[model samples]
Target: MSARLPENPAPLTQALDACRHRDPEGFHRLRQAVAPAMLATALHFVQDVRQSEDVVHDTLLLAWLNAGRFAADDLPPGSWLFTILGSRLHSQLEALAGRPPSAPRAVPTGLQGQALWTLAHGLEPRPPSASLGDRLTESLLARLAAPQLPRTPTGELVHPPLYDARLRRKMLTSRLAYQAKEGFKRRLGRPLEEWAFRRWLAQRSVGQWLEAQGLPRRSVEAALGDRLDLEVNPGRLVRCMSYPDAFPDRTERRKASNLFLWSGDWDLPHHSLADSSRTRFIQDLWTHRLEPSRSETFRRLEQQREQGRPLRSHHKGMLLDSRERILEYLRLYLLYMENMACFGFDKHEGKDRLGVTIDRHGRIIKTNKGLHRLAMAQVLGLSEITVRVRSVHRQWWQRHAGDAKGRDALERVAQALPECVPA
Candidate 1:
């Protein structure tokens, strides 16, 4: 007799909860539900039915072992299962093919015959339909059945070449920056600075260059063309038509192009540029320099105004309307700086230093240090100076401020600072 299963409203959620609570039945149900999808995803990576199946089995075991760690709000059991399957399959594929598993190559329509011929020599099961899942299964089966294709001779599977993670991260960062800038431009009705936009383009260009060198033609086209919206046709034509003499030496050209495209400028003395510099520039651009501008912030505020609704107003008027609000803006700036520091901006100079000192014309009158302490006090919602000194800075400023408290302390501090007139 078929076993009866529990009828829960959200079986997946219930299974996850049960697994967290150490219920064997819930764990089994979750495993069974996710196994097929994991198998399918694994096959897509490994391209060998037996190995793919093995990978799925191993992945399921691992998932079950780690089931207690799974959160209901995180990915569903199927997706989590797939992640494990994909990672294991990648390792297997790397071993068998002697290279990393990259994005799948697009088989040409005419090459279907070749693929079918390849499968015929292997143990791939032919499914009734050519659905994506079926195709994946077929590919895996074919690879398993015929591990040694005559053309390959050594019985190795054809795999795409591996790229360093740094390249991938750089590419992704540039793409995100471009999208963010475009979104900002749309909202603000003003284009981002040309230099900034070009820098983004350059990083994308470097990624394309690496992909062109490493990826197969179809894979290269798919990755650069479809995802990044870059036209590889023009790049291909340029590569084909240009004579060796017209370009710098191969090594120089690659280095220059990588830097120029990724760094967004060819101004550096090409011969003198070091690999560290190139890497540093890419790292800096990726982390610190590629953020949405203040213009975006103001534009968003304006948009809210146009919609006949607005953000909360203080007694002075709109939150962004007065000079005091500049302090609030600077607080966000500090947060941005902190984010940059966390994301590999430590190497670059000036990134560590806070900008926007309160100045009259060109002469510096005030600094962010005092403002930050004040802002932190406000954020902590302190009302009394004695309370703030005790709780916030721990009486560090008591000797200077005397017994002053609250707004009076702030006023006294500001008055004490030198007020240099505008130049």
Candidate 2:
């Protein structure tokens, strides 16, 4: 395949032109436009991290100086850049390797931008991969999982007004309808939706409804089309959300939970939601300073168990509610304290990993998704833990990778993954 990706980036000539005249923003734009592709080609072709980086840096530095002589139409800037890059590579080992890597002196943030590109410049989706669950389980068994993806914080993330009458009203209506449908489906024993609608009203919606009668709603769709993103976190990711968001009661509930995805503006003061009893109690129990029996979550489960309530709900089905799955949970908490914590976070990506959502700026927000392990991480102070990026805001995809196509988007995500996690 050619060094350039099949598609050309937005005109690099203009940005280069701006550079010729010494314009700062133009320089930034030009680098953003071509740096990833240039670096990808160089790195993949050379298979040397240090050498590839130097080649890209030297090529860009040379390009900056020759911005005036550069013209766009004669040859794509990507092609020209790669040409220079290849030339640079010939000398990198002998001439450039020992020389200090070229530091971007134009802007202080130059280093930051390069760091982001290195992190986001990923090959997450070339050879097609297994589900996030499978990969995580494999890693866990091998005992080689360390996950931390540090998120780039937006200007200021402020929570929007929590009470919106119209939205809440609509949400209420949707919930009521869902419960009614579920009630009917449960009563009918879910023979693919139900026959009442089919016989009485043979519509497409009814037919579709019939197809989805008893199964729990589909929850795992990070949508690499059919593939899931690799759980590569080079930075620390504090588990973001709670159980309710992680395990919504209804399908609509999950969709409506998009409230956190909204831009609350970085300037406004943001306060994390008060830690739920689940988080607080677990931290308390983690110390063994307090008896696990004193935990309200544990006590509630004990009482519920005595009353014949299931200790772990949904014992054998999709989207199990283990809302009451507390007894064994206590034992597992001890396992970690006693140095037997083998099940790294990713192993639970199928359900309980710290689930989070990214906003337009790729800021991971708490959605109450994975509290149990999140609490453990807090107590353990583990530097790295795998996360289930359950969903990303539409704007996040658009902003990170325009067009947001599957391959590009996932790569962009992988590139960004390093920034979100700790080094």
- CA lDDT, every model vs. true structure: 0.34, 0.43
- For model 2, residues 1-423, the per-residue Cα lDDT tens digits are 122233443556677787788665665565556655666655654676555654555556556545765667666665555554544443343233333222111112322233323432453212112342243233222221111211112111111111122233444454466678768756764443234233312333443332223112122232232332334331244334443434445654543443222222321223343355656665566544224566665666667666775343111111112432353356435433322122234434323445566655566654466565655554544445555555555455456655443334446754664344311
In candidate 1, what are the lDDT values of residues 360-414, reduced to their tens digit?
A: 1212211121232222222222222110010011122233345564334434533
What C-alpha lDDT does candidate 2 achieve relative to the native structure? 0.43
RMSD of each: 28.4, 22.4
| lDDT score, candidate 2, position 362 | 62
- Compute the lDDT of residue 415 as modeled in candidate 1: 48
Superposed model 1: Cα runs more than 4 Å off:
1-9, 100-423
Query: Any runs in candidate 2 off by more than 4 Å, and if so which?
Result: 1-252, 256-274, 289-291, 294-329, 336-353, 403-410, 421-423
